[model samples]
Target: MRPFNFEKVNSGAEASAAKSQNKQFVAGGTNLVDLMKKNITQPDILIDITKALSNTIEHQNKGVTIGAMASNTKVATDKKILRDFPLLAKAILAGASPQIRNMASSAGNLLQRTRCPYFYDVTMPCNKRKPNSGCSAIEGENRMSAVAGYNNQCVAVHPSDFCVGLSA
Candidate 1:
């Protein structure tokens, strides 16, 4: 991993102001850290927003408003979520292993990248990983590729158990 500057912001406005072309907001660091290690992303600055963002699960009149920084495990086990949205809880629990869910944030889970093998391989050409580099999964092994709603740019399927539940 390349050296980078890190800052912990205390508010959304601060985080937004700190944003730049070479900077990225990090919450749980689940996806961003992995991408950085893989060289798929190389931000010069990382603004830590885990504390800046809300982590509470709010009970609304019609539904629940889950904070972006709330961990997947927190959402899955929240009393209101389990009582009001049991399916969502079940879906999140079904998606990632217990350890991952405990570390992954709700917002981070929603923004996760594709799980395509080509995307993870820096040596392989992947349009999603590097635009216009060409999609390696097209002609290569594509069992996990999308059946529909795919273009030449990408064919990987979204792999988030929590996302699936939220969508439903």
Candidate 2:
């Protein structure tokens, strides 16, 4: 990964205030770190919001409120979620391995990058990774790519099964 300054913020407001063109808010670094290592993202400042964000799973009126920083494992194993949203819990468990679930955050999962191979390879051209760079996935192997909502610019599919479950 490129050399960058890390800042730990204690609140969303502070994170927002610190965010700028060269800064990014990071909760779980699972996805962001990978992208950075691949040179897909090079933020000058990384604002860590994990400590500042709530990790609680609150049961609201006929629904649940999962904190942005709550890990997938926490959400899957939470008594309230397991009891009230069994399918959701199952879906999350089915998505990633146990170790990843323990470190991956709910919000971070939703915002994770596409699983397109080209997107992660700095040597390959990808529109999503670099606008107007030309899409290499279009003519390459794309069995896992999207069939809908795809255009010339990008055909990458969202790589989160948790997101699919949440949407359902």
Candidate 3:
């Protein structure tokens, strides 16, 4: 990962105001850090939003409000979440491992990138990795490729169990 400026904000508003081109908001750094290490994404600035966001799960009149910084483990084990959205809880528990789920933030999980092999390989031509480059997964191994909501430009599938559960 290349050297980047690090800024810590104390609120969501501050984090939003700090946004700029080639800047990434990092809470748990589960996805962003990995992408940085692989050179998939190189941001010139990293806005640490962990302290700037709420990590608690608040119950609301209709349902619940899950903080963006809330960890997967917190959401999966929260009594209200388990009672109101058991499927969501189960899905969160089913993802990654205990350690990863503990560190992966709710927003990070929701914003995860596709797990397509071609997208990870820099040498491979992937439209998702580099737009207009061509999608290698379209003609290559595509067992996990998208069956719906896919165009000719890309066929990659998001690998987030929590997202699938939320959709259902």
Top TM-score model? 3
What is residue 40's positional error in candidate 2, in angstroms?
A: 1.0
Better of 1 and 3 by TM-score: 3
Residue 10 local lDDT, model 3: 97
* Regions of candidate 3 where Cα sits further than 4 Å from its true position: none
Candidate 2, superposed: residue stretches over 4 Å from native: none
Please give, for residues 52-113, the per-residue lDDT of candidate 2 as tens digits.
Answer: 88999899879998899999999999998888888889999998889889989999999887
TM-score of candidate 2 relative to the true fold: 0.91
Query: How would you encode candidate 3's per-residue C-alpha lDDT over 69-137 as one tens digit per residue?
Result: 999999999998898899999999988899999999998999888768788788999888888998888
lDDT of 1 at 2: 93
Query: Per-prediction count of colliding residue pairs?
Result: 0, 0, 0
Supply candidate 1's per-residue lDDT for 32: 88
Per-residue error at 54 for model 3, in Å?
A: 1.2
In order, candidate lDDTs are: 0.88, 0.86, 0.87
Task: Sort all candidates by lDDT, best to worst.
Answer: 1, 3, 2
